[model samples]
Target: MGDETTHIEQAGPTELRDPLVRTEIKRAAVWIGMTLAVLAVIVLAQPLLLILGGLVFASILDGGTRLLGRVLPIGRGWRLAIVTLAAVAFIVGTIWLAGVQLSGQAAAFSATVTAQANSMLAWAGTHGFTPGEVQMDQIGQQLMGGLGRLTSAVSSALGAITSLFMIMIIGLFIAVEPRLYERGVAWMLPLRSRDRFYRTTSRMGYTLRRLMAGRLIGMAVEGVGTWFLLWLGGVPMAALLGLLTGILAFLPNIGAIISGVLIILVGFSAGVDAGLWAIAVYVIVQMVDGYLIVPYVARKTVDLAPALVLGAQLLFGALFGILGLALADPIIAMAKAALQQNADERSGGKAAAEP
Candidate 1:
């Protein structure tokens, strides 16, 4: 041998292992494979797995309430109960109000369609269009055909309900489980990175609370303001539509666009005047959410660019439909946080050595 010999070091600060060294490669491989396997299983069982996925965030939510209660000067449980009950009441009330509006508007729309069939056919004919009868006949057939598939999809939806219940149970368990997941994660992390994972998991509950608070507040503000605008415009079903818009708005950019499109379509169906009002309602709400509500409410929430958020929505939506669309933001935020934390650790070490 020459004057020196090489020594193996542990993996890079952020990666599973150092590619240049071989000592821990098998360990890293096993871990990586295991993680991928679990993800594959999740993807395969997504309809069922979705609920479990939700539990991850719910744990964050309920976890936050506990923290808030702790920080408050009074009994912790009392504060949490009051806040939770208020949230439940608000949701129930919004649903009830919107349901009433939906029934009224839906009934009116159905009647209008039946009574105006001949007139609509005549209008289509004058516009150099195919006869309205042919179009309606085709559409009616498609809708009826779709009913079967929709009914079949209901099974997945029922599974969804079960999933939601599962998430709730899992979340409650996680919130009280003495950070078992955290300890497990820490065990796998490199010696140097161990402390950070533990610390992050300790605060995971708080992170969830903060995220939920921002999300709920932003949504609430957007929802109320939107309903007021729709109501003022004398838009049909404004209350119900606003609630739908608000709920969908939870998903950020893509959600807003979807709700806007639906509002516009519904508006058009209501006639030119209603259509115009609906468009205005959507535009005003977007402005409010984009400029005022989102900026103010999400101030401390993850500061993701709208474009990035939308991109994630597109990618996730393609793979997982509405569920992915709903979760894209927080999932992306969590990823961003993890990356930044790793980068900071590396940079800090480099900077310390430079001086």
Candidate 2:
């Protein structure tokens, strides 16, 4: 027993001092640290969402600058200036044209939404799923409480406006000096990994640009088509519904579902005919987007799995609310590209270049 004890004593120090054991301990430490870091970031997800919004805005500006560059024989700075001015003009014009109509419809839209809610409650009561007034009140309270929490986490309206300003400023800075940020990131990595980091980032940028383009095209088409069809059908709140459709289009599959529900509810508030017409419009818009627009965009961008995107949206929405849900697909796409590159590296293969 004494001999065994002595042997273990000797082996313990030896193992501690051994280079391989030390290396493994260091590796374990690194993994643990990395895991904690990731958890910390997830906990602070709101600020991360803000940063992500900035990056998305930067990508949009950069994309516009690039397009303008191809068309005009001008310097990049000049092209970016032109593109920025045009974007501002377009936004102002849109608001000027639609603002009054949307405002006028706002109260009616709210009334319709409330009526739809009451109808849903009535149907539930008929089906023997009725809740007492107290229970309904509690549910409403809980929902408002949840939304209040989300608002606090994301900041209030003024805070949101400030965030928008910050995002635009950050985006502008990034667009103006993209290489500076890229190099700054690369500088943080080990010298040996810098080349790989740059390559991965470049691929990610290309993927992001294409993804944004596809999304913008889809939003425009969906918004315009829905508005035209709803107007022809004389659907109530057509302008508001159209606006929601456009904004929500940014969120891909999940957004479309929510917008469709809203449109149907508003349409039904008018009449059965209007409801049917709205349904037809919804189906037609989705069909065109699915069969034509999305396919063409998918060819340019990475094809995300519907299930994966939906899952990510749910998870992100739960964790980070609306902003998280909106950006979920892009986050997933970037992750997919990075993971694919890593897998290729492990297999001693090269990742395919972006189209």
Candidate 3:
């Protein structure tokens, strides 16, 4: 036993642990660290995701450009141009349509409110409640105060627009040079390790792309369905409601609830019967979305527990405002996938015990 112990000691740490083992340990540690960093990035670099999203969008545009570029195949030089043109067309079209519709709706809404206010004032006058220009001036002051809020809202909206523009610029750059980035990253890694690193990143990118595409399609369907239904029912603010429904669909369960509340509010304002009918429509639509739409569209999407998603949202919301809320689902989904992978690895790991 003493001889064996001496021999073992003499063999030293190098024999006890292979260099590859050490390398793999280092790799795994780094991999885990990178995973954590990604989570941190999601939390911290959310604004960047908008840029990333834009870049992803640009990359999609690049695909189309590449198709045409092949004959005379322009380099990615035309990428930014193509993306910018497409974006301009989309934005201009959306704005033109939205502006016309919103303006007409807003005018009608304002007129209705004005008529109501005038009727109330006249009734008060007939009731011998004579509050004259002084009351009108007080009301006007209140209106002016609300206008101040609009100024802030406009400023906020402008900031959002600027942020989106920056995102698009950043996205265009990233999309154009995605391979450059991969090559750069791989260059730093050892030859054998390079393939693994590239594979990991490629996997992530492919998965995210597929997931986002599916999610966007699902949202579009939900939006179209909701809008058509609301319009059929002659619901007030059908256009706005449809937009809201589509946007909210990305959020899952909470989105349905939010849409329902909006429908109820619109219904209530329209009158008791309209409101009841509207609520019925929203509930039915929600049921269809939950049971039918989610099962098929989100089929390959994250299959997480409802409780977990909701809990994550609450937990994230408490730490950060809306950014955390926005990230909660994606974050949770990634975590769940990681955990499942780890479990599988452990189950398949080399062991002394026989199965």
Candidate 4:
């Protein structure tokens, strides 16, 4: 018995294995596994990005179904089918109408862009801010090189028709049965937590719907308004620029800057007066969106922080290209909602009181 007691003393505390050593080992293993998983995701980011794109489309369809239900008294299936058909028809009509004009103006657009760039360079030279044609040449080379890289990256990852088909199919399936997927996810959670999970998902859906509505309204307003004003102002490539602006408008801050720059540049290519008119048109369109459309939509949904959205855009853009950048705001909004719910739960629903 004395020997056994001595042996026990020498053995020390195996209890530490359960409370400390085992826990530490488990933690280390989890961290390592997470790191590997993240690395794998980064490597396979293209497919993941495609999946995310499908989710965005699904959200749009889901939102449309809900909206149509309010007015049409139709089943989800009929509503979804109607919305999808209408969307397809709209796209086809737009393309058919613009196809000839866009093709014809393509060369003129390129020439105008080049002229504006050279003019900008010359202006910079006159201001003593540029070293003349050498700097201009360098800038052109850099721009071309960057574009080449971007094109290569995009083509390599998403050039396949198969990818687009896959994305569309995924989105169609998800939209067809959003509730099934939502319930499945909730079912995976503990029974006590499932309500919270469902609530979070519903909140996220509402937020996304509002966000997308705002985006679509902004895009339509900007595109139509810009096209009309630019055409009236006799700016070259009015249709193309307007279409570009409308699509880019979906990206918020960065989109505005890009569209503004393109408009100003193309406007300048025509004349100084045209440039001023383009600026005026831009200001008017943006003012209307800012004061009217955005406020109305924001009242219905969560207002995202500009910096957070921009950061997500940059990070996602680097990882997954244009699709990531385009979807960044919605993704961030959804994530923010989820995180807020988690925080509220962790704080015993007292987080709502703190600030």
Best by lDDT: 2
Those runs of model 4 whose alpha carbons end farther than 4 Å from true positions after fitting are 1-21, 92-100, 131-153, 156-165, 345-355
Per-residue lDDT for 1-355 in model 4, tens only?
3455433343234656456767877899999999999998878777777787777777777788888999999788999999878766765566666666587787777677777778778888899887756444677677445432232335643464455556677888899988899898888889998877777777777777777878888999999999999999998888898998888889988898889988998888778899999999889988998789878877776677678888888777766666677778888978976787788778888233111
Ten residues in sequence with the least summed lDDT for candidate 4: 144-153
Of the two candidates 1 and 2, the one with more favorable lDDT, higher being better, is: 2
lDDT for model 2, on a 0 to 1 scale?
A: 0.80
* Model 2 misplaced stretches (Cα beyond 4 Å): 1-28, 89-101, 129-155, 346-349, 352-355
| Cα lDDT of model 3 by residue, 179-199, tens digit | 887798789989977754554
Clashes in predicted model 4:
0
**lDDT of all predictions:** 0.62, 0.80, 0.61, 0.78
TM values, all candidates? 0.68, 0.85, 0.60, 0.85
Q: How should the candidates be ordered by lDDT, best one leading?
A: 2, 4, 1, 3
Under the 3 Å rule for N, CA and C atoms, how many clashes does model 3 have?
2
Give the clashing residue pairs of candidate 2, or none: none
Cα displacement (Å) at residue 280, model 4: 0.9
CA RMSD, predictions in order: 9.2, 4.3, 11.7, 4.3
Q: Measured by TM-score, how close is model 2 to the native structure? A: 0.85
Residue 185 lDDT, candidate 4, scale 0-100: 81
